[model samples]
Target chain A: MIYLELFLNFIYVGITSFGGGYAALPIIQHTVTKSNEWLTSTEFTDIVTISQMTPGPIGINAATFVGVKTAGVLGGICATLGFVFPACIIVTILAVIYAKYKKSDVMSGMLRGLRPASVGLITSAALSIITVAFFGQELLELTFASVDLIAIVIAVIAFILMKKVKFLSSPIAIIALSGVVGGAAYLIQGALV
Target chain B: MKEKRNYKILLPLFWETFKLSAFTIGGGYVIVPLMKKKFVEKLGWISEEEMLDFVSMAQSCPGAMAVNASLFVGYKMAGFIGQAVSLIATVLPCLILLTAISFVYVAFASNTVVKAVLTGMSAGVAAVMADVVIGMIGKFIKNKDVISVIIAAAAFVCVAIFKVNIIYILAVACILGFIINSRKKGAGK
Candidate 1:
């Protein structure tokens, strides 16, 4: 019964999700918290927070957590497999089709349209994260601070380093430096405020 | 010269993808350069332009960029067997890493250093994402196509402000693509 439910949930999330992992967030939130009642809204939020903090896609993380909470280790396996199953199958079919249709005009035209949409989605996500990291749940009007500004600056600098500096191309190093900057700002704010 | 052994071709592709899957932290744009490094510079599996094309295609698809990119790269490298190996390799690491991390998370759910690192890295992640967008924009602008820009703006408004469902956005894009292509073909005739 648990396996069946897991299978169903996996297929539901996998199939309905069409815009990538970030786009699946609302669906996972609604299903787990609102419909299934497996996780409270608070728990769902926490899972999202923690999942984002860790490395990997949020969909897989949520699936893994929900799977473990509902059942156990086997549940985890089922859920992970379910989450990845769609992409696996799609790629297999696409691999063969792609061979024959590699240079089709129709395919090229479709791709040209898809590019802008993809860029839009990616930009939206980036802007949202920037807002949240800087504003921290505050309203837009009341949120302008130095640390926030500094974080943005750090991001820009890191971008330049990545694009131009050539040697400081390590994402890990840039990430660590940004954290040090953020922590220092936090401490300074604590002392001043 | 290509090897004659049956498993020889598949093994290297699988191993390369497996390593990438295991190590690539903060998915998507973060992995782009790493991919460029491995696929273009190191392995010579595909050319740089082809790599960029694969990234563009992966983005338009309906899955994680890491997974989709891996699928294309793997297929381009070694065909069906390459795809299978890459999928397994890509997914296996995340599964194992998350499973192990899940246990530790239960205990150290609120570690300070961990939190700090995550908060900081997230900003960097945002930067990488912005870079990808800018890079794509540069590519699009070079084509000097008004249709692409208009569609891009429309999609941005739909997703970012209106928060319209992504499926609808994708569907509309697909329809628009078909319509525009067909009309152009008809006019040519």
Candidate 2:
């Protein structure tokens, strides 16, 4: 039953997740946290972090992670398969149809509509993650006093490194460096206490 | 003869996809330029125009853009079976790696240092997410598309503030887009 639920949930994600993997974050958050209560928001953010660190599309990594956490290996397989099932079928059909009508105005127009919307979804998703990463709560409840300065500083430094430093631009390097920084900070605090 | 030729290329196709999926660190977009080099320039399996078309189609379609692009290119080259091989090859590496990571992650979950590290990594993840948003908006600004900018802002509000379902937002945007585009066409005519 859990496997079945996971499959159904991811199938929905695969079908609706337009724009890209990042766009799927909101949908995943809706299903896993809001609807199913399978994971809390904090855990959901953790999965996003893991998905980025791992090699693959964020959507697939998330499906696998959530599936494994929910059920087991079988669940992971089912969820992964479910997530990509729609894409496989739909893209095959689209390939044929688009090939035939490569210059169709209707198709181009639809894409134009979709493009900005996808950006919007991605922006919202980014905001959601920022809220969780810094405030540890919903954005609406955010107050000046509730902000986690340590997280804010780490995020700013990571962004600067990725944007400015050529050698550390890769996401994996930034993540590893942040982990080291966090671990070192904790060790220092522990020593002092 | 064509059928036999496709069968011969299947293993190579799978291997190429597997290698690409395994090595690429970033998400779907990162693989595109590299895929072009291998599939178009080196392998000569697909033409440059065809590869660009595949990338665009992959972006427009659902699922991961990277997987979609691979499947589309495979289907173009060798048909259904080729699509299957490419899809499996593209996903298999990540599937295996994530499974392994999941097992180790459980064990590390309780470690204090690991927890602290994960906490710190979360911040980095946030910054990356912001960069993605900025990159998208920057693209719009460069294009100087006011409508797209408006739609992007509206969509942001709809989701972040109103908490509207994404499906509805997309639906509205599509309709609005179609209407505006058709009107522009009419004006041009």
Candidate 3:
């Protein structure tokens, strides 16, 4: 029954969480915490934090975290399977359709449209990430006081290196170096305090 | 036509996706640029333009961003099995890490050192994304289509300033492209 409920709830999340993982958090929170009571409000919030801490998509991370907590390892697999099922089916079908009709004028037009729109979408995402990183605030809520100069310096320097230096192109290198810098910042702050 | 399955290609695809799934932290948007680096830039499995097209299709659909992108990539490179392998590979890291953390979540969740590392990494993530935006927009600018440029600018404002739903903006932009391109008669992007 626990496995069934976990699969069903996450399947529901998969079917409806149309935009991306972040926008789906509230809906997931409602289903897991409010309706099933599988997790307390505090636990659900903690899962969100954990999602941030871990690698990969937040939606998959949350489903696995909840299912593993609720049932066990197999439960985690079940919940994850449920969550990814719809996307696989939907995207596969769409891909087939796209492949078939790709040469059509309408398809070509839509592709044209998507090009600029994706640029916009990615830009929006970039801005949001920049806001959270440099300012420690949401996109709409930035202020001069919330600014983190250390983070900004890291980002700018990384960007420059990524552009100029051949070896710095891989994101893994940048991410690892950023972590070390961040860890050092933490230690320095702790020592001063 | 059933695409012939090649274990040679399949193995590398699996390992690359698995490595990326494990290391790509931050969030959804970050993965695309990274994938561009891997698949388009390094592997030569896909072209630069083809990568963007797949990205648009992936982002347009509903699902985990990471999963959706992999689906397109797998489907292109290795067909249905590739899709399954990529999907499994993408989710495997999450399942493994989250389950492991579930046992000691209380400690893991409140660890300030982890927070600081992620904070610093977020800055790195931002720079990566900014580079992506600039790179993509640079390509768009090369086309020198005034209307397309306007569309890109307008879409940015709609999302960033007005806080509009991204789907709506995407819908309108797509339709505009359809109408305007078709009107030009024999024009194709």
lDDT, residue B185, model 3: 80
Across B60-108, the per-residue lDDT of candidate 3 in tens digits comes to 7776888888888888788888888899889988898999999999988
In candidate 2, stretches whose alpha carbon ends up further than 4 angstroms from where it belongs are A1-79, A99-102, A144-146, A186-193, B1-86, B101-106
Evaluate model 1: give its lDDT. 0.68
Please write out the lDDT profile of model 1 over residues A71-130, one tens digit for every residue.
Answer: 776777787678767766776676667656857877666666665665666566556666
Task: Please name the candidate that would achieve the greatest lDDT relative to the true structure.
Answer: 3
Candidate 1, residue B16: lDDT: 77
**Per-prediction DockQ:** 0.42, 0.40, 0.74
Q: Report, to 2 decimal places, the DockQ of model 3.
A: 0.74
lDDT of 2 at B149: 95
Residue ranges of candidate 3 with Cα displaced over 4 Å: B186-189
Candidate 2 per-residue C-alpha lDDT over A102-135 given as tens digits, one digit per residue, 9 for 90 to 100: 5678866766777787677667766776787788
Error of 1 at B72 (Å): 3.0
* A152: Cα error in model 1, Å: 2.3
Against the true structure, candidate 2 has what lDDT? 0.78
Sorted on lDDT, best first, the list reads 3, 2, 1
Most accurate candidate by DockQ = 3
Q: Candidate 1: fnat, from 0 to 1?
A: 0.40
